[model samples]
Target: MKGRTKLTGLVIFRGDPGYEAARKNWDPHTDRFPKVFVFAQRTQDVSNAIKWARENKVPIRPRSGRHSLEVNLSQVNGGLVIDTTKLNQIKLNKKAGTVVVGTGNRVGRIANTLAKQGFIAPFGDSPTVGIGGITPGGGIGPLQRSIGLISDNLLALEMVDAKGKVIRANSKCNSDLLWATRGGGGGNFGVYTKYKFKVHPAPAKATVYRITWPWAQFEEVLKAWQRWAPFVNNKLGSELSIGPKKGGNVSMEGLFLGSKTEALRLLKPVTSVGTPTSSIIRLLPYTEAVKFLLPPDPILTQRESNQFSSGFGRKPFTNKAIKAMRQFLENVEGQFAGFFFLNWGGAVSRKSPRSTAFYWRDAQFYVEWNSSWLKPSAAPRNIAIVRQTRRKLQPYIVGSYINVPDQGIKNSGPVYYGANFPRLRRVKAKYDPKNIFNNPQSIPPANHKR
Candidate 1:
């Protein structure tokens, strides 16, 4: 392990020329330096890294896109980092309606690559998000309402477990592992190497729409959206973002798996509530539509920093809760703060809670409280805004979304897994009893506490 000449992938030690660059995370806020960085080129390299860490009595962290909000969960000081970004390989079984993707593949790349072959898989809005991180946490995207979460379509996957053993999980074998992976979130069971997902034929064409209302009308819009978006139509998926009233605005945007006319007809309820300041509606090919939904940092080649907390709403917001939300948006101390409501019903609710580890299947929509800052001194105020908003909406929300990891949350085990927490603990004990794959928020073994 000293020279790393026998390792398949390049290994960098502290003070190495490239170590500084390799240790940085996608989030600028995450400042952690590992003793060694392994840019794993193949599945075997991941196993080697884990084995090396165990032998050396050093902790190890597995990383792919490096987008975890709680960055420390995927990184540790003076430990070993197993980076799987170089394991990117995609194989398509077009006839079987399936695609095998490497864990390092990004969401945007996955969409574009599969669309070319007239097939696609459900993925989140961020083009830079790694399939490895999102799939295990229940990937929600534009097509989610119509099809289902990315986890719902996961057919099989390969992983390097805590014992350095490569294992495959699917319906026929290691089914319990498969059940735990779907919506159980990452950094729990093991390091995922590859995922084979059941794909659907790309929609010939899709429509996208964006509508904005003045800050003064934010309350009205929120009320209407909460009552409508989730149940609007199976073919339409939408999200509402309401920025701080102090220098921010409110907007709604989403994609529809139908023609422009159909999208317009279904959007009448939203458009009728208030006169929008601006509106843009377009019909484009499936791939183009998917690309349009990409986040600000589409490729994630650069670092972005932010803080946020998310939860699921089983029912519409109460009038009191809506007022609290409006008051918080209007009076929040920070300027770069907002609340997001993402549609979350249709096919998502069709599955029972126990079918998969994803616990909030019956939720109508999910809520995310977000805040950002430019300086360390400015972080606390912005962070407070997010926590306060969560407190305001606490009574109306259920479990939290594991995808948006939040360190501020207490009782994370129950909040993230709900009734499935117990089963997830069992899975953790089975595959990672020694807790080689772990983090502050990671699922613990049968009797351990968070």
Candidate 2:
């Protein structure tokens, strides 16, 4: 492995120009530099990278999207990166409501392509996010409650393990592999190349709504909305995003899945909370509604958004919790922070948690606190805010969605996976006993040494 030809499949060493861009994800706060990167175009390429790194006794860090907040990439400083963005390929069987896509494929491409066939994959909130990272990590979105988490639709997977063996896993084959990949989160096992998943007949037409609440009513609306959210009908979905408004005000951003007429009827409690300064709700294609919550256009956003770890609440946030949220909001500077409450409980939780590796099966609400700032100097404060919020909400968290990982700083594996920790650890021990795939928040094997 001394010269260029000595290494395997599409290697780029320390000086390669592509190495810089290939090493980083979208999170601007991280500063990681791996020894080399393999712009793998096929499974063999991924295998080669893994084999080379392991033989040399170097750790391997896998990156798919630009969304990983944790420093998973940073660990590759003297190791290797199996860059799979080039392995993108989508094999669709539209009639069967199924798709076999390369893990590198983004949510936007999947959604747009599926739209043509009158079917659609549950795209991640961001168009740029890669399926490799999201599908395995348990994705959430407007369509999540309506259809289900992206992992719920996963039917099979093609993976390259730490041993560099190419294996295909499905229910009839490697069922344990399928279960671990669904929600065990990334880097706990190996690199996933492709995924076989179930798609849904998307609504021919859909609707979206945007409502802004006045700053003065933040406390009242925050508490009441959480209570009203879990009780809403299965077909309807709403999110109460609380953020500082212009001129030091506060706002609530929402998304609903129905016509203006029906949406109004369903959102009466929300409308009654505060006199919306700006109210806009209208019908559109299912595609359009999906895009509403995740606009491509840049708006006022936190620059250095910190880690977002989430958990499910059994009931609406209590008065004490609501007051704490309000107090936190009161302290956050208008320019750089916000707390988001995505309402849940729909067709999603109707199924048992045991159905998938994802443990938050009975959760009614999802909470994410993000601190957004424009400068590099802002990261410490942002990270602190996220930590404080997690401490405050610890009691209310029943189970967690793995994708929104807080890296390696959590109290214990039990804090993240609830009752599923023991099982997940067992699965880790069984499949990745060598611990070839590990990062900050990954599940350690039963016989873990460090």
By lDDT, the best candidate is 1
Query: What clash count does candidate 1 reach?
Result: 0
After superposition, candidate 1 runs with Cα above 4 Å error: 1-7, 295-304, 331-336
Choose the strongest candidate by TM-score.
1
Error of 2 at 201 (Å): 0.7
What TM-score should be assigned to candidate 2? 0.92
Tens digit of per-residue lDDT, candidate 1, span 7-64: 4588998998998778766666765888888888888988888888887878888787
- Per-candidate TM-scores read 0.95, 0.92
Lowest lDDT sum, 10 consecutive residues, model 2, at 297-306
Per-residue CA lDDT of model 2 for 113-184, tens digit only, reads 787677857865577777888887777776777888788889999999888889899999888879877776
**Which residue pairs clash in candidate 1?**
none
Count the clashes in each prediction.
0, 4
Predictions in order: lDDT? 0.84, 0.73
- Model 1 earns a TM-score of 0.95
Cα error of candidate 1 at position 362, Å: 0.5
